[model samples]
Target: MSQCLNPDCLHSNPKGCQFCQKCGSKLRLVERYYAKSILGQGGFGRTFLAVDDFKPSKPPCVIKQFLPQAQGTATLEKAAQLFDQEAQRLELLGKHSQIPELLAYFTADNRQYLIQEFIEGDTLQ
Candidate 1:
């Protein structure tokens, strides 16, 4: 299955679809990551289950798309800045076994994304 990365659609698409049926958005991201399903979402961001093409096993990953709830240019800029900082922090914290390793952080299609190793387990929530 192919997952629509568009925040508006955020649904699974047919395997061969080049574009999203719901929103007509592209079905891939960063040329390497192919999202398969949305894991979850909040007011601040959304997370996706994706596969890395570079890996021989096509390892699953978590693609965290930054979507700030606040409106306005200044707010968006601040959100981007904070997201960068968080990426840096994750890089450091990833050394510990408990934290997921940060794989990549980049911007495309006027949006920000943080790709990390998908840790399969339960959460307190």
Candidate 2:
């Protein structure tokens, strides 16, 4: 299942598609994970339920796209700092059983993304 990253897309494209069916957004990320669906959105970014294409079973993972609501030079710097801080926190907390494990964190195509082990359950609403 290829997920369209375009914020306006309403549907995901067919599996293995290079482009999205609805908005024509790229379907692959970092040439490994395949965005399957929108998991949720927050003030900082949107999370996607993705699959690790590099894995044989295509294990599910959470992909966090950094799309901060604030847009200024200083704000962007702070966002990046916070993002890195969170990544470090996750890396430390990953040793525990409660929090999800951080899988990868890097920038691609000028966009920042953080990948982690997906935890399956209802959100704590």
Least accurate 10 contiguous residues by lDDT in model 2: 1-10
Per-residue lDDT tens digits for candidate 1, residues 1-125, read: 89998877777888877788888887778778889988998876999999897889999999999999989999988888999999999999989888999999999898999999998888312
- TM-scores of all predicted structures: 0.89, 0.88
Clashing residue pairs for model 1: none
Name the runs in model 1 displaced over 4 angstroms.
Answer: 122-125
Number of backbone-clashing residue pairs for each candidate, in the order shown = 0, 0
On the 0 to 100 scale, the lDDT of residue 73 in model 1 is 93
Candidate 2 runs further than 4 Å off: 8-11, 122-125
* 10 residues in a row with least lDDT, candidate 1: 116-125
Candidate 2 accuracy as lDDT: 0.85
Deviation in Å, model 1, residue 14 alpha carbon: 1.8
The lDDT for every candidate, in the order shown, is 0.88, 0.85
